[model samples]
Target chain A: MTTKPWDLKQCIKNYSAKGIHGITIWRNVLEGQNLRDARTMLDDYNMEVVSVARGGFFPSVEEKKRQAAMDDNLWAINQAFLVRAPVLVLVCGADGRQPLEKSREQIKEGIIRILPEAKAAGVKLAIEPLHPMYAGDRSAINTLAQANQMAEEINSDFVGVAVDVYHLWWDNNLQQEILRCGKNGNLLAFHVCDWNVPTKDFLNDRGLMGDGCIDVPQIRGWVEDAGFSGYNEVEIFSHKYWATEQKEYLEKIKNAYLKFT
Target chain B: MTTKPWDLKQCIKNYSAKGIHGITIWRNVLEGQNLRDARTMLDDYNMEVVSVARGGFFPSVEEKKRQAAMDDNLWAINQAFLVRAPVLVLVCGADGRQPLEKSREQIKEGIIRILPEAKAAGVKLAIEPLHPMYAGDRSAINTLAQANQMAEEINSDFVGVAVDVYHLWWDNNLQQEILRCGKNGNLLAFHVCDWNVPTKDFLNDRGLMGDGCIDVPQIRGWVEDAGFSGYNEVEIFSHKYWATEQKEYLEKIKNAYLKFT
Candidate 1:
């Protein structure tokens, strides 16, 4: 298990040596590191890049700002290429400044704008459908079926969906969608996290894999059976884990993946 | 629109006079006034009780207490009858001290045990499927599909389901399930509440309809289209509402239901 105190280099090194596949990173981690420097860092550790942090939150009211959002997304796609990552995860933007239909249209238009850049950069953009809890301010794409609907409409090889267990565990159509995404070649990335029973805080109470009650293995089985063999990326948003030493958090992550994945 | 400190009498009185069809009660309100007295009070108010507070939490390893639980459920069913409520709402029991399968079997058995008593008392038992978040502790029946599965297994016209907006709002197949439940004549009660953004507390913090972002009228349209004609029973579980006077709460209920329902 990778320990929490480990930096990116140590994480990749340990993960690679242990036959653990790769790691997904947060945007802030790359804020100071230059794209070239980050690329070199991955090369030095002999680690694979599963995905870049993210690039989508498309909805915007001002037509002027919509261009800026698309420009930012282009930059993220370029960053994913720099890291040699195949996918740049995208969150469907919320209905913040306009009606839902207008926002949905905006999001669709924004995605179409980015598709050319994504294809040129050789990076597939993964449409990450957040739980409906985030439907108002986070993402309008709130279900796998909805995400797939957008993906089909776009009809691009560069666009797909990331199947995150934390956001999708409760979905009744999860298994069916997995098979559909798999058949349509829409399953771009796989992320794992547990849903705590009490789920104290909406944004921060995410559990470590196998620590909470979600049937993680069952979901993994469904994804695997559907032909998704990507990295089972761990992404817990636990305040408890955040408060602990990074080394311990990493160790728990490694152990949980081994146990639950 | 319902205000804080809800008044049982005024709510019933107004509902009855307006021909606003049904009433659903919480256990605290029922027990606070004593179940028997509450039933009598409701009868005097001329409101037809739609459903009882609840009868669930069946999964427990404490075999010695199983009979006690059954007896209490029997009492709840009798109360439902006394209040002239046709349905006794039930949440599938949680897994306590036993494996998930055992707990599921036990719940089925527990429901069977109470079915005779419920039938004898002329009360229909409505199985309410809670959100998957409550699968471990609150209720195991987490999906409308799952509730329908149980209803089929229970094989009784008296056993049905309560479609609570708070719990089923995020479901992808909700429209189909509502139609299916209605088709089978299994849609006994339709409870209404909003899913607050950044839901602060699972046990409380339900938003007043139209205060939150749920498409209430859309769902209401589905239920009605599927042949449901019951009252849009408002059941807010917010500490904020509980903090005010009962009269204010009743007024809010009336206003919110009028505007949102």
Candidate 2:
């Protein structure tokens, strides 16, 4: 995980050595590095740049704050373009000071504004619907249906949905919604992680696949059935794993991926 | 709240003195107390029994555990009968070892097995759909739509759904689902609480109404429009509020109920 204390280059080498096919580059990892150097390192290690880790935090109660977020996202889009990642994941923001509906509108507006730049740069924007528990502050877009609706409304080739099992495994309508998303050609990415039963931390208590209750393979089957042939991106946020040895953790992740996903 | 150290008699006296309209009795508060005495105390205070706090934990990996859960639920039903509560709220349980569909089927089976006893005792069973965050261990029924479908399939005067704004407010289809529940004559209870923006604890960080992002009054309006005329139960689990002065907290609750609900 990014919480581990590895430098960007070291992380790429470690991932490449472990036969990890791709890496989603967090913006923080690129803070002090040159984008060209980062791209060169990825190429040297045979590590495909999956996507820029995140770009969206579009909702804000203040106009100036909203403008600042868009400005940051535009920068992230450029970074993704420079790094040769095809997509920028969006954790569309929510402002507790306003209603969720208002925050949702702000997210839509923000995405529409950024779409032209993203398309011109050949970088798609993947709208990731967070879990409902994060609806208060992290994101107002908390369901696949909502993401699909937003993508449809935007109607842009560069705007689509990212299917994360952790956020969506609990919904009864997930399969149908995934089908609709794929039917509309809006499934941009597939994220894999498990939900621990006694999930201790709201954000960082994610389980590795095969260690929790999610039927990841079943959901993967649905994604493949719906014609999504993208990377099965392993996006995990875990305090426990971050504290462990990076090598051992990467090995475990590979095993879990083979066995459970 | 039940987490408070007050016994049943004292709680009733305190609630009555505060002019609280009703109390939802938890099984723990009834320990070592005579049910007749509890009912007499409610009558003496001229307070209504809103509903028994809970009755369901019906899913288990083991058959014996499942049977034991059912037995405890049947006893809870009898207790609801003795206390003159019209409904027993069900926090339908989930087993982490199995698929969610299995846990859901087991919950349905458990409910059907107990429906006759509940009907005979004249106590309605309200399936409380928890938030998806609790789907792993608390309740597999995590949407108003799922609860509505389950209740309709069960089809009895005694089976219905409890709409909790804290759990269901993030849902975009909530109003439509509530309408469907009402149309099926399955809307039984409504619980109120706000969701703190940075919810510190998953179980006990709930905010008082108007203190968090949820529009409680909006959800209440939707419930009312869907023909639910029952008591607006103030169900909150908050470590912060529990650590504060109980009298002050109860006063705040009353004000919040009047102002927001």
Candidate 3:
């Protein structure tokens, strides 16, 4: 993820100036800033915190690391509540040292441990299934179907799934999975970004809406059909974009969002 | 993918010298060489052509291009037959300009068009499902489940699925899909490689067996359990490996094969 130069306050100001209605708060952006102040800034800008930008690296081979991850997620839930973000997106982690099954089990256990806190805070924990490419170290959950299944198993109103076109666009079962999630009232968030053809970097080469092959509008249609009336969050992690003039890049994003997304 | 250095004869000699039992031939290596002579070379080295490296980029937006792809696959089938290779691995392609569904449809049609020739030539077509990262332009078939479904729908012995660890190791349904492929007698080939942790290149940063996170032996066990006793083909495309002294790399491959794979 390459967008690190802009701080939280700057991001909120830019988003509001660009007519962007919502923002997802990455945890790093909250560092050194008071949560209450961040909330105040969001209110001043009339910007909505669609979801807190991540709260799960649950899988770890080490017992201490797993406990620490759980503790960190609890902290994230509290942050999400303070920021007035209704959903906390989770990139459930994977441990390369252990079997994926074991890592998945740990993820389940971690979520269970944090679900109570999430519910108490009225901040839904949205399990965001990452792309299969990240399955080695990023996330064990790599499919909407898997996320949907997990959410259903967890069976709480506070637990749900975030449907991201960037991660899930390639899946043939995406529509069916979206429908399934929506049927179960598990669709919590929707993130949009395109998959670049010659995706240079696995983590930061995401395309703007119209720059790549992904049919974002079609996937958005599916999401909307599945009753997701939330923000079509533009979540690009592009090194190229980050290197450009931020204001000009913001204009391009707005144009792409209006014309393509 | 890396490894563009050696010719077919050199590859065979080097592999045989390193005591590598199998080699999958890329189609480019067959150019300007007599197929009969290639077969003779294989016999001389006492090495097996595991599967012809590729033969399907069937999806294209243009009708002529699609036809050309089908023709190319037919040629690949003949090459596989000439080399005494039983299978031709297909990277069924996707067109970024079109919907994945359209690309997939074209792939199915292309396979049906070529199936009769494959059967006549006694060359099985192995539909190797690529990683989802490649779904935009390389192959719409990104899951082993999709490959298995396609193989079953085809319902011919000439058509089967190639299970590659690099593409499919992350899949939650991998074991079950392997079982399904095995039960249908459609498991044509097994390719082995590891997903590098910080995989530098999406196309070529493949790790050696023990160098990365994949539990190669465990996946091998699954393949074996599913009745696949074929060559555990060491198919890696690594920039790092290719940059090294290939002989030393070959030795590393042998060691990894014996120890981890």
- Best of the candidates, lDDT: 2
Can you rank all candidates by DockQ, best first? 2, 3, 1
Please, what's the RMSD in Å of model 3? 1.7
DockQ of candidate 1 against the true complex: 0.28
Write down the TM-score of model 2's second chain: 0.97
Going through the candidates in order, their DockQ values are 0.28, 0.88, 0.79
Across residues B126-163, which tens digit of lDDT does each residue of candidate 2 receive? 99999999999999999998999999999999999999
Candidates arranged by lDDT, highest first = 2, 3, 1
Off by over 4 Å in 2: none
Q: For residue A86, give model 1's deviation from the true position in Å.
A: 1.2
Residue-wise lDDT of candidate 3 within B128-240, one digit each (tens)? Answer: 99999998889999999999989899899899999999999988888999999988899999988888886788888898898888988888999999999889888889878
Interface RMSD of each: 4.0, 0.8, 0.9
Q: Point out the worst 10-residue segment of candidate 2 chain B by lDDT.
A: B1-10
Q: What TM-score quantifies how close candidate 1 is to the native fold?
A: 0.87
lDDT per model vs. reference: 0.78, 0.91, 0.89
Best TM-score among the predictions, by candidate number: 2
Return the interface RMSD of model 3.
Answer: 0.9
